[model samples]
Target: MVAALLPRERLLMGPGPSTVPNRILRALAAPTLGHLDPQYIGYMDETCELMRQVFQTTNQLTFPVSGTGMAGMETILVNLIEPGDEVIVMINGVFGGRMKDNMERCGATVHAVEIPWGQSFTLDQIRQAVADHPQAVMLGIVHAETSTGAFQDLSGIGELLHQQGMLFAVDAVTSMGGHDLQVDAWGIDAIYSGTQKCLSCPPGLSPVSFSPLALEKIESRTTKSRSWYLDVSMLKNYYTGGGGRAYHHTAPINMVYALREALAIVVEEGLQPRFERHREMHQLLRSGLEELGLEYIPDHSLHTLNCVAVPDGVDEAAIRKRLLNEFDIEIGGGLGVFAGKAWRIGLMGESASEKNVLTMLAALKKCLGD
Candidate 1:
């Protein structure tokens, strides 16, 4: 006979699904309501407003897509991309490669500007890409690459693309709720972010937003989006405010509850303070690692996610295993090119705490026999 489900509490210091707070978990346990129930609909509206505040945008199209971060990416791509369109994809790490794949699947002719996985792209490289791909209608960039912990600066890139009449898309899956993401100020036309990272929520819903320019392009698309489930044109009808509702799909009722509460907590704490907390925790971890003779993978890394080189002569997987089994802690091994050669540590949401950082340092010292 199958036993009851009981999962141990492991301190999540990995890339995502960061430590969820008890308040958010309790919100998820609240009785499931009909997807379109008035109370639930009100909750959805509030969540959208909260998302706008978190993203620093006044875009009315902001709402949580009922899936993981990848779904949000596909939603933006399928709604904006069609056959024969030229899109410049900036590939600095695994998530950027995923964007390329998504673009190709949408029948977009992709022009990729790639750099070393652990570094941000140079301005010259970006300029060259746009100059070479003169017909490109869109530029896709990953803001926080969890795989490499490299942070891309969209501060000026948005204005650069806007001047050329190109739509700007961003994957903030790992940066949202943790980093300083200014969707409007950065001129990001279409952006997607996950709640699991810095929102102190379990992985499920992905918050997405589209600027007016992006919505105009979607409205002008001649062909249907390849993905019916992720079609923003269809989703907008149900998600946009003060509209007659059309049932698209049954919303992830409980996940919405969790996200609503999580976003509320973020609002209570304020964005600047949350971002500062993540940065300070990252600094604490960085200093601790440096004292242990460890080096960061990237010269400029993300405050929410940190990548560090695995010590030579040490078994990387074994170390992670020990960190898990012996210390009841959880961290991540690297991905793609850096796999088995590095570790991906996350200081996200509730996990980005001074106590957590100190505990991780103490545990690692013990495991490393220091």
Candidate 2:
């Protein structure tokens, strides 16, 4: 006979899948409802409104996509970019690289502007890129580069893009609730994020928003979007309300419940306070790590995710293993070029607390034999 499945709880201090709060878990366990049920539709509308509150945008088209963060990325690209459309992508880290790849897969002519992994692009570089690629219809960038813990500033870039007659798209997968993101104020035409990172929700849904300009661009696309499932035109009808609501696919009922609950938590805490909490936790962890002779990697690091350099002669993988085994704590190692050379410590959402920071520091000290 098959045994009943059970999983041990571990503090998630990794790059993602931040530790889910009990309230959110309970929300996930709520009874599932039919996708087209009127109650579920009401819940969906509430979720969209909550997303707007968190995103700080009045965008009517904001809603959660059915897949993870990457799905949100694809949805934005495939809808706005058609075959042979020129698009400029800023690539500084893994997620930025993924954006470039996604644009290419959409058959768009991509102009990729790259900087070092740990550094962010300046406004001058952005201006130069626009000058170099005048024909590009859209420019995509990662607001918080998760792989390298680098936070990109979107403050003035949005207005610049709009003035240049180019749409501004952003990947906020790791920054959404943890950082200050004003989608409307920043003039972001379109943006996408994941639930798992700073929302303190499970990995499944990707919340995305489209400005009126972005909607116009998507509507004006000469060719059909390559992805039928992620096509925003069909998605908007289902996500947006009114008497005429069409079903694109079966939405993830329980995940929506969980996200609704998580977003409610965000709204209750308020965005500024939530962002300050994350910053405080990051500072606490930074002080502790620096005391242990570690240094940060990013020029402008994300408060939600911290990437620190590992000391020479230390077994990065072994320390991670010991933390998981002996301390029942989970943290992340570096990716790509920083693999085995850095540690990616996340203090996202519910996991961003003084208790978790102190616990991780103490556990790490033991694992490092200090």
User: Any runs in candidate 2 off by more than 4 Å, and if so which?
Assistant: none
What residue pairs clash in candidate 2, if any at all?
A: none
The local distance difference test score of model 1 is: 0.92
> What value does the lDDT take at residue 223 in candidate 2?
84
In candidate 2, what are the lDDT values of residues 242-307, reduced to their tens digit?
Answer: 437788899999999999999999999998999999999988999999999899999999999999
Pairs with backbone N, CA or C atoms under 3 Å apart (clashes), candidate 1: none
| TM-scores for candidates 1 onward, in order | 0.98, 0.99
Say which candidate scores most in lDDT. Answer: 2
Off by over 4 Å in 1: none
TM-score of 1: 0.98
Question: Where is the poorest 10-residue window by lDDT in model 1?
Answer: 237-246
